[model samples]
Target: MQSKKIAIIGAGVMGKKHAQTIVKHPDTELVAICDPFSDAMAQEFNVPNYKDLDDLLNTMTLDGVVIANPNRFHVSTAIQCMQHGVTCLLEKPLALNTAEALTLIEAQQSLNVPILVGHHRRHNKIIQQAKEIIDAGTLGEINTFNALWSVYKPDSYFDIEWHRVAGAGVLAINLVHDLDLMRYLNGEIESVQAMTSNKNRKLEVEDSISILVRFKNGALGTLLASDAAVSPWGWDQNTEENKTSFAVSPDQDCYFISGFEGALSVPNLEYWNYPKDQSKSWSTSLMKNKVEPNKEEDVYIRQLTHFVDVMNGIAEPISSPQDAIHNIQLLECIELAAKEQRTVYLEQLQCFKKSA
Candidate 1:
């Protein structure tokens, strides 16, 4: 397959990573870097750097574009790209809120091209393996999950002005990942109630949040995240998938899931089931086992490959525009629930009402 040309829309951490991987992936070629403050990466990659989208669009036709820009720009940029017949790989927290995300999701309906959301964890081989194990009935009617994301950020990390705003909290940055992972591994979340606080640090945004989730299949879950914690539990702390993030020693587990047949832990891939010949009871001992994922390429590279296929009509997006929008709605509902101190059901949201 010929390499499809692509451009990075943000020059920050994620955009740099995307640019590096795009240039290296067999199916993708780095066309240019597009950011207002981006001469550095452009000089480094030897590609033209445009301060705005119109200039880049006028210059050349791209097979696709990656929107790694700020939270507020996501919907507008993606809508612009899609309107101009360019597919996009939009980063997570699809829009600033459910309302904006729903508008973009609506706009996508008029287009046939793909819009793959950057829920990169879904692309992981280990996550795929876990999905298979749960589907195989080995876990036997899985019903609950205990999700955690607890890590510490230094005082200096909040120096960025937006980092102290309403949309830049742990709820937006970290919990979004855990919410998507839970939906991908478990099922659709039907309702949510949450509480969040900036108790750990005096900031405009929350430093921690705890959530209760109810799935469409009747499964329940607890999703919690805190940037003020001193210990490790999140995927960043438990795995080495991204060496840029902190990885814990001895690899602590971040998820503990249970089903009728047994229990399981994520990343570690540990499974516990009752003895085959023994009567299942509180007194019976459970057998321990482990699952190893099939070797695969890096997830981000795989996501790019998937996007290449998605753009070329070889495959559908793993996280479609609608999927991205739903995650945002989930986050919105969680925030609303936290603020109002009440449970929020998915179906009652205006987005859902529009869909129905």
Candidate 2:
């Protein structure tokens, strides 16, 4: 088959990364890049660049478009691409909230083109193998998942102009990944009770949040993230304020999924394949099986490849726009649950609208 041509929207960090991979991958070619910025960096990449989406859409013949624009711009960008008969691979959080994401979902399904969201962690080899083990009933009756995401935030990160938006906080940018993963691992979250605080941070949004989740299957989950943690990674911790230092260690961002019979841990993808003997509880003799953890495969490359494959009728996309809507609804629940300090059901999530 002839190589597929791809257009990348947004020339920011993610756009550049996708462009690099598109050029490097043998299956696709980087035909054009679209961005409103006039930075010289756009030309440094050496592909055709456009000032806006229409200019690129009117001129280029693209098989697919990867949107790496800001959260607020995702829906509009995706709708335009789909209307033009181009399959799209959208970056995470899908959109600012559920309502916008739902609109795009409708558009894509009606257009008869594939729309793949960039939930890259789902593409990890270890994650895939773990899903297979769970599906195979090796870890019977999943009971709970404990996902903790904590990292130091740069001061400049909070200072970004768009950080003022309601959907720009830890819930959307960080915890959404964990929420989507948990939903992917188990099932829909049935109810949520959450709390959030601004604490020493100088931002309009909460710097720390803790969510209590009850899944439809009675599995319990806690999604917690704080910008106030002193870790040096990516959270909002600063040393001068507290004069206490925190180190980025080996186990930060690690997650685990536990079942009635066994459990699986991340980075290691260690599976406690419970022994087959039913008489004796396998907890004590839990045999450990280590699968090769999915390395840092260029997830954007894999996502783009999948989009092209789905367009060509060779493969089906795993993360559809419908999945994005569900994830966004979950996010809406998290925010509402946090604000009201009360349990919110999945069906009770309110549709979010754009700010005036």
Candidate 3:
């Protein structure tokens, strides 16, 4: 089989990561790059670097494109790529807000182009295993989810002007990933109530947030995150998925999920339940079991491989645009809940109505 020719937009952190993964993957070829500002990566990779999206689209025949551009440009760039019938591996949030996300969702539905949103954590083998355990009723009738994402980013990390602004806070930049995973692992969120604060960082954007979510499946969840604190309790720290970007806290778990029959902790995959022979009551001691997850494969590589499958029409996108739009809507509901000092229902959001 021939390699799939791939081009990447936005030569930033994620763009570079995708380029490296693409080059290493057996099924992909790095054909070109599109970024108005930088060509350093393209030069290093020995690929043509076009400064314009149209130029890259018109000049090169690409089997797929990865949109890792700035948040503001995501929808427009994705529409352009779909216009050329190119599949996309769009980076997350899907868009800055639900309205923009809806436009991209509508475009994909109309053009029949596949878009696999880069909620790359979904590809992690641990997550795959966890999902299987839950789906198989091992954690029967899940009732609660508790997650934490706390870490202190270096002071210099916020030196960029945009980093202190409304659009680039812990909630949008960091917690969105956690919230997406919550929705992925738990179920659709029916409503959300939240509170946010920027007192610690004193920036225009929030540095800490606490959210209460009610899943459509009757499960309740709480997410607490802070980018202004020192801690080792986030998925990034616990999973070691990106060691270069985040320090690993070995053997730590970031999520605690419970149900009537059993309970599970994430990353570690520790299972606790009463013995089948014992009486199912508080008086009974719980047995601990371990679930081993495949640690050999890199999630980004798996995501790239899945993207190849999406491009080849062999597999439907694991994270489709319609599926991702809900995450964006959930984010909006969180922001609204914090701002209004009231619970925000997902079905009540205007964007959800528009999409529906």
Candidate 4:
């Protein structure tokens, strides 16, 4: 099959990742890089650079684009790509808020262009294996989850003024990821309650958040997100999933999922349950076994392959626009819950009014 032409829209950190990964895949050609601030990246990659998306769209015929722009611009850039009939892999947080996300949703539905949201964790082999275990009844009726992302960033990362501001806080940048993961692994969230504080940096936004969620399936979960803690208990820190990411401490358990029959710990992929044929009882000793997923696939490679498949009419998107919209809407409810100190239902999220 002929390779599809794709362009990288942002030259920042994530744009760098997209550009590097695109070259490794044989199914895609890294046609160009577009970013006014990233001339160095363009020169290093030996690709033509366009300071504007309009110029790139006009000058190059691209089958797709990967958008890693600021959260506020995600919707608009994606809408432009869709209007041009180009497929897109838009970075997460879906949009700055639910309203901005709706504009792209409307455009996508009306135009019938494929716009895949970049909730890359959904593409990870380990996460897929964990889901399959739960779905296979190995962990029967998953009832509770301990999901967390607690890591400390050095002071250098806060040098950017926007990094200390509200929309650029840990909630938008970090927590939005696991929010999608929870929705993906569990199911629809029925309600959420959250509390936050900025004791660490004392910035415009909270530095830490504790969220409680009730899944529509009757399972319950808690998500903790903090950028101030000096620890190594997150997906990125625990797995060799992506070597380009910083490796923190040696591996440790990042997730603990339990159901009626058994429990599973992530990264370790350890499975625990009472022996079969033995009566199920608290007194019965539980067995510990390592549950290994099939050898992992590079997520970027898989996602890029999937994107090419999406462009070629071979496979559907892992996270479509409709599915990813829920993540942003849920995030809205989480913010409201933290502010109001009350449980916020999914239905209430339907009309949440963001503060001006």
Candidate 5:
């Protein structure tokens, strides 16, 4: 079987993960990894590596590229890869801002190539089952949803240069995932009222953010994210008392969703379809399929595999550059609402208005 050649930009933690995925996947070969900090990640993955995007592009014959660089570098790297006719699976938030993300999207449309965004949460088995339940109308009308995402960023994390960027902190890096998930499950966000602060962390970007969002379908979604907790991870009943940190237990990482008819939780993507009085409330369940808990394989592998598949004409790309643009537009709304202490209307995302 012929394998597709792939290049991963940014030899950061995430970049190395994508490289490992490419090397392991049966359908792809990791041609090279590019990053200015290649030395920092030199031994992280076994692959042909480089220190610059241009070097990798010039040196290798590649079918796709993975943009796992800093948030600010996403647009330029994606544009470069796509302009060369290479499919890209870009890391989330799309870009540092909506305008840049939209520009890339327009360019992507002209190129007519698949550009998939790295929103791995969208591929979680539990989340997939929840979406199926919602579409099946087993949940009835979705009235309310709450997404809580919080973690303590350690002092070491602050040492990174990009971590200090104005728009690269928790809001764009962390909450963007939940925000995208909300849109994935419920629908478009129509408006948002938000609040954010950096009271605890002495950083350029806000460490904590909370937003009240109204979905177009009238579903109320409340999303929260923070990196200000004393311990990054919360107290666990099973662990020793001293085990208080940002390290999340696999069991605890699960999310849940509730509706008029039933509720669905991680590990148990089950649904109680019947009402209180109707035939004992029918219950259907799906057991969690535990794949190897390797971060590289679970998230980055599926992401790269999806990208290679699209490039090879095996599967259609699921997340388009337009999706990334829309997600970034939503992130922009959240940022503005939080900064100004006002409700940001979805229509106000004209900053990402399609260019003529």
Candidate 6:
């Protein structure tokens, strides 16, 4: 098969990562780059850089474009690419808010162009294995989930003005990834109750938050996140997916899920259940087993391969725009819950007004 030609938009950290992965992948070719601010990444990768999306689109015949631009430009860029009939691997937070996301959702529904939202964790072998295990009924009738994402970012990391602002807080910046994975692994969230605090950093944005969620299936979940605490109990810390950005906590587990038949811990994939021969009671000890995931592959590479499949019509997007919109709605519900000091149902959000 001929290599698929791919272009990257935005020359930031994520764009550079995608460029590197594309260059290395045997099935992909790095064609061009579009970024208004910087051409440094384009120069490093030895690709022609254009300052505008239209210029790049008109010049190059691209099979797919990786939209790794800033959060604000996500929806517009994706729409532009789809209008040109190019597939996209759009970075997450598909839009600034649920309302903005709805616009993209509508464009996608009308255009019928494939867009793979970059909820990249879904490509991790560990997560894939966990999904299979759960789907196989290994953990029968999931009842609850407990997840943690607490890590103390260095004080200097917040020196950037935006880091201290409302839109760049831990909930939006960090916890969104965890929440996406929760919804991916568990199920759709029905409602949420949440609390946020910024006392640790005294910034305009919250540094810590606690959320309670009720899944549509009646399974409950709790997520505790803090960017101001010193802890090694987050997906980034436990998984080596982004070691350059986060220190690894080799022996820790970040998610604990339980059900009537068994309980499971994430990353480590430890399984706990009573042996069939033994009596199902508190008096008997539960058997412990390790569920091994497939050999590790770089998640970004996996995501790109999947994007290629999506572009070729061989596979549907694992994280479609419609699916990602729910994640945005979930975040909005949490924000409303925290702001109003009350439980917020996912259906209450205005983004759901049309669908509901």
lDDT of 3 by residue, 1-356 (tens): 89999999999998999999999999999999898898899998999899989988999999999999988898999999999999999998688778888888888889999999999989999999999888989889999999999999899989999898986887778887888888889888899999999999788999999999999999999999999889989998898887998999968899999999999999889999999999889989999998986766899999999999999999998888889888888878888899999999999877798875
* Backbone clash count for every predicted candidate, in the order shown: 0, 5, 0, 0, 5, 0
Q: List runs of model 6 lying over 4 Å from the truth.
A: none
Instruction: For model 1, state the Cα shift of residue 5 in Å.
Output: 1.1
Report lDDT (CA) for all predictions. 0.86, 0.74, 0.91, 0.84, 0.69, 0.90
Better of 4 and 6 by lDDT: 6
Q: Cα deviation of 196 in candidate 4 (Å)?
A: 1.1
Off by over 4 Å in 3: none
Clashing pairs in 3: none
Model 6, 1-356: lDDT tens digits are 89999999999988989999999899999999999988888899899999989999998999999999988899999999999999999998789888898899899989999999999999999999888888888899999999999999899989899888986888888888888888999888899999999998898899999999999999999999999899989998897778898989967899999998988999899888999998778888999998775537899889988998998899999999888888888888888899999999988766687644
Global fold similarity of model 6 (TM-score): 0.98
List CA RMSD, all candidates.
1.8, 5.2, 1.2, 2.7, 5.2, 1.1
TM-score of each: 0.95, 0.87, 0.97, 0.93, 0.81, 0.98
Which residue runs of candidate 2 sit more than 4 Å off their true CA positions? Answer: 39-41, 161-166, 231-253, 273-285, 350-356
Q: Rank the candidates by lDDT, best first.
A: 3, 6, 1, 4, 2, 5
**Candidate 1 lDDT, tens digit per residue, 69-119?**
987799899988888899999988678776787788788887665799999
lDDT of 6 at 188: 86
211-302 per-residue lDDT for model 4 (tens digits)? 99999899999988888997778877776665566675435877788998999988678899999989999899999988675435888887
lDDT of 5 by residue, 1-356 (tens): 58988777887767776776677888887767787764555455556668777877777788888888887788888888877888888887677776776678788888887888888767654456567767887667777777666666678988888887787777776676677777888878889999887888767778887789888888787766677764323222111121343344544433455666555543334444444444533353422323222222254456666776788778876676676566777777877887788998878656744531
Task: Report residue 253 deviation for candidate 4 (angstroms).
Answer: 1.3
For model 2, how does the per-residue alpha-carbon lDDT over 1-356 read when each residue is reduced to its tens digit?
A: 88888888888877887888788888898887788876454577677788878889989888888899887899989998888998888887687767777778778768887888888767655567778878887768988787766766778876777675565678877777778878887887788889987876756777888888999899998777786675433211211111234443433225678887778876456778656764446345678887765555655567666777886888877887777677888778878787777888876545532210
